[model samples]
Target: MRNQILGRQGEQVAVEFLQRQGYGICARNFRVPVGEIDIIARKGDVLAFVEVKTRHGNRYGTPAQAVNFHKQKKIIQTAQWFLRQKCLSEDKCFCRFDVVEVYALPEGKWQVHHLPGAFEC
Candidate 1:
């Protein structure tokens, strides 16, 4: 439960950070049978399928490290489905996988690390 809350808060921070970076948010929590995408954003002709990872500290590892091979595969599959559903040609509209790491800090502040093209589809 606590983790979920932290994750939600982190996602929000990621959204704000992405907006600042000029990425227009397209969707949030896009879920399908295969997998789920935390956030989807668009910039120019690029569609970014984002996975958000949040942590209080880096004791285990950086939040982005959590997205391993299996997770990447699932996100890729879901991104494919999303493109088909949206009737967007993958050839014309470029697609990218991004990971946004949000670290909760002291004094009610947070830090965001946006990794664009973090993975390939």
Candidate 2:
């Protein structure tokens, strides 16, 4: 439960960060039997499938570090599922994967880091 709460909070922060940067949000928490994509946004012709990671400190490692190769594979598969659902082919649509790292600071504020085109799908 605690992890879910923190993850949801982190996703909200990520959404705000993207919006502030002028990305229009298309979906949140898009899920399938295989995995879930945290956020989907568009900036002009490029569509983004975002993965959000949040942490209080670097006790384990950086937020991006948590998204291991296995996780990346799952996200990629899910992204493919999403595009197919939208009837959009990879060749026709401009799409990319992004990672948003939300640091939960001691002061309760957050630091959001956006990594555009973090990986290929």
Candidate 3:
């Protein structure tokens, strides 16, 4: 329950951060049988499939570190399905994978970090 709450909060912060950076949010919590993407946004001709990671502290490691190879594979598969669903050809549609690290701070504050092109499909 706590983890889910933190994840939701992180995703919201990531959406706001992307919007401020001139990216138009296209989807949130996009899920399929294969996997799920936290957020999807577009900037110009580029489509970004984002993975959001939130942590209250670095007890384990940086949040981005949690997205391992298996996770990346799942996200890539899901992104491909999303493009096909939208009738977008992979050859023509520019796409990239991104990671948004959200650190929960005291007093309802947060620190956000955006890593564009974090990984490839």
Candidate 4:
């Protein structure tokens, strides 16, 4: 339950960070039969599918390091599904995959890092 709460907070931070960076947020926690996307945003002509990773410490590794090849594949598949569902042509618009890392500090403060065009399909 604590982890869930932390994750929710992290996602909120990610959304706000993206918005401040001039990305128009299209959706949050978008779910479909295939999978779920943490945040969907647009920047100019690019459609961004973002993954938010949150951790209390760096014991494991950096949050962006968690997005392995398998996870990337799943995110790509989910993005494809999302585009089709929205009746948008993949070829007509540019698509990008991004990662947002949120670190919960010891003093109850948080840090966020946004990696735009972080990965590709």
Candidate 2 lDDT over 5-25, as tens digits, reads: 999999999999999999999
Q: Name the TM-score of candidate 1.
A: 0.97
Best by lDDT: 3
As a whole number from 0 to 100, the lDDT of residue 114 in candidate 3 is 93
Number of clashes found in candidate 2 = 0
* Global lDDT of each candidate: 0.94, 0.92, 0.95, 0.92
Q: How does residue 61 of candidate 4 score in lDDT?
A: 93
Q: Over the full model, what C-alpha lDDT does candidate 3 score relative to the true structure?
A: 0.95
Q: What does the lDDT read for residue 83 in candidate 4?
A: 93
Tens-digit per-residue lDDT, 1-121, candidate 3: 9999989989999999999999999999999999999999999999999999999988999998999999999999999999999999878979999999999999999999999999997
lDDT of 3 at 15: 96
Candidate 4: the clashing residue pairs are none
How do all models score by TM-score?
Answer: 0.97, 0.95, 0.97, 0.95
Model 1 scores a C-alpha lDDT of 0.94
Model 3 ranges with Cα > 4 A deviation: none
